[model samples]
Target: MIKVGIVGGTGYTGVELLRLLARHSGVKLQAVTSRKEAGMKVAEMYPSLRGWVDLAFSTPEDARLTECDVVFFATPNGIAMQQTGELLDAGVKVIDLAADYRIKDLSEWSKWYGMQHASPDLVEEAVYGLPEINRAAIRDARLIANPGCYPTAVQLGFLPLIEAGVIDAGSLIADCKSGVSGAGRKAEVGALFAEAGDNFKAYGVAGHRHLPEIRQGLTRIAGVDVGLTFVPHLTPLIRGIHATLYAKITQDVDLQALFEQRYLGEQFVDVLPAGSHPETRSVRGANVCRIAVHRPQGGDTVVILSVIDNLVKGAAGQAVQNMNILFDLPEGTGLDIVPLLP
Candidate 1:
């Protein structure tokens, strides 16, 4: 069995990791760290795991992370970089569910995240953990930099077009909306029910942190620097990400066929039949990205709708998927969870 440890087990992504790992047949939960919640039973803090997780949260200092086969950092950005080197040296594979090592350019990452990268040397070494794009690299990587929530949705929507050279990569727009839970389990005025609920508004138009990460991934796929205007909105719901992507068509091809063929063998990416609009709820609670392609009135602009559960495909679930790849397990092992629908 693969021994696993999770750092930062108090946030939404952290608990989501626990929920998924608890039932993984091939995994043995070794340790979960939470400085503040140390000594608290995992089930006591999150009743959802009452019967599955009997381990108590331990402080990072007390956790036996080096002994685990793989350690997932579900903590904030800086935390992982601070300790990843030691973990990797100890033969422990590390997967960071944060932006600590996603962007290859350390200066650019610093500019956007507003913090000096603690381990800039590891930036180039950490493979970006998007299985659809970097599956081969992830298999041999000891350090993984998981893609951000918005980037995951937006990139999956635009990848096929970019790869086929059918869309103008110079001017791409990602108008994405995410649920309140994407903000993490925090006590912030902006994330409070009274402020986020019954409201729909876009923030970070000036430039969200995910913008660079998206551009970086798209640029790699397009083989050129891609221009992207990414705007993120906060919806009142608790889970899901809806990304409406727009790109100018440079060629005329059957978009439905293109998407279908592009993701023909991808287990997590679902390409809907033509004229279908994917809903975020359809992918809720599951590690899946449901997409639909359209060219309204046969215009030059092509629109793609992509949806996924932010905490699942966008975070913890994707982390687990990467773990499966790293361990040479079935790609869908422990991730065959059906989407939770209303």
Candidate 2:
């Protein structure tokens, strides 16, 4: 069994990892660290995990993470980079659910995240953990930088077209909306119920951090630098991301067939039948990205809709997927959750 350690187990992503990994038959929960909540029983803080998680939150120093087979850093940006190199040297695989190593350009990452990277030497070593695109790399990687929630949905929606080179990459527009929970489990005025609820507005229009990451991925996919206008919005719900991607169709091949064939064997990416609309709720709580492709009025602009539970496919669930790949287990071993619907 794979011994697993999770750092920062108090946030939405951290607990989400706990909720999934706690029951993974192939994974043994080793340690979970939360500096502020150290010594608190995991179940006591998140009653939902009462029967599944018997471990208590420990300080990072007490977690003894290097003893585990794999350690997941669900901490804020700079925390993982500070300790990842040591853990890697100890032969423990590390996966960070933050922006620490996702952007290859250290300067770009620092500019957007507002902090200098702690381990620039390891930046190139950390694989970008988007399983659909980097599955083979993930299998051999000792370190991984999990993709952000918004980037996950947007990239998946635009990938097929980008790969096929059937879309005008320079004019790509990702108009996306995510649940309030995407902000993370925190006490911020923006995330407060009274502020975020009954409110529908966009933020980071000038420049969102996820923009560079998504652009970098698409550029890699297209084999050329691509221009993208990525605008992220906050919705009133709690756990999903809906990305409506727009790209100019440069070719006439069947749009539906393109998307379907591209994701034909991909278990987590479900291409809905033609003319179907994928709702965020349809993928809530599940590590699945449901997509629907359309060419409005048979026009040049192709609109692709993609949805995923931000905490699932976007963060924790995807982390577990990477873990399964690293351990040579079935990709869906611990992620076979049916999406929660109302």
Backbone clashes per model, in order? Answer: 0, 0
lDDT against the true structure, each candidate = 0.94, 0.92
Misplaced by over 4 Å in model 1 are none
For each candidate, C-alpha RMSD in Å?
Answer: 0.6, 0.7
Cα lDDT of model 2 by residue, 223-274, tens digit = 9999899899998988889999998988898988888888989999999999
> Which candidate's lDDT is highest?
1
What TM-score against the true fold does each predicted structure earn? 0.99, 0.99
- Residue-level lDDT of model 1, residues 143-175, one tens digit each, is 999999999999999999999999999999999
Cα distance off (Å), candidate 1, residue 15: 0.5
Give candidate 2 misplaced runs (Cα > 4 Å). Answer: none
- Model 1 deviation from native, Cα RMSD in Å: 0.6
Q: Model 1: how far is 250 from its true place, Å?
A: 0.7
What is the Cα-based lDDT of residue 313 in candidate 2?
96
Candidate 1 clashing pairs? none
Q: Least accurate stretch of 10 residues (summed lDDT) in model 2? A: 333-342
Query: Against the hidden true structure, what lDDT does model 1 obtain?
Result: 0.94
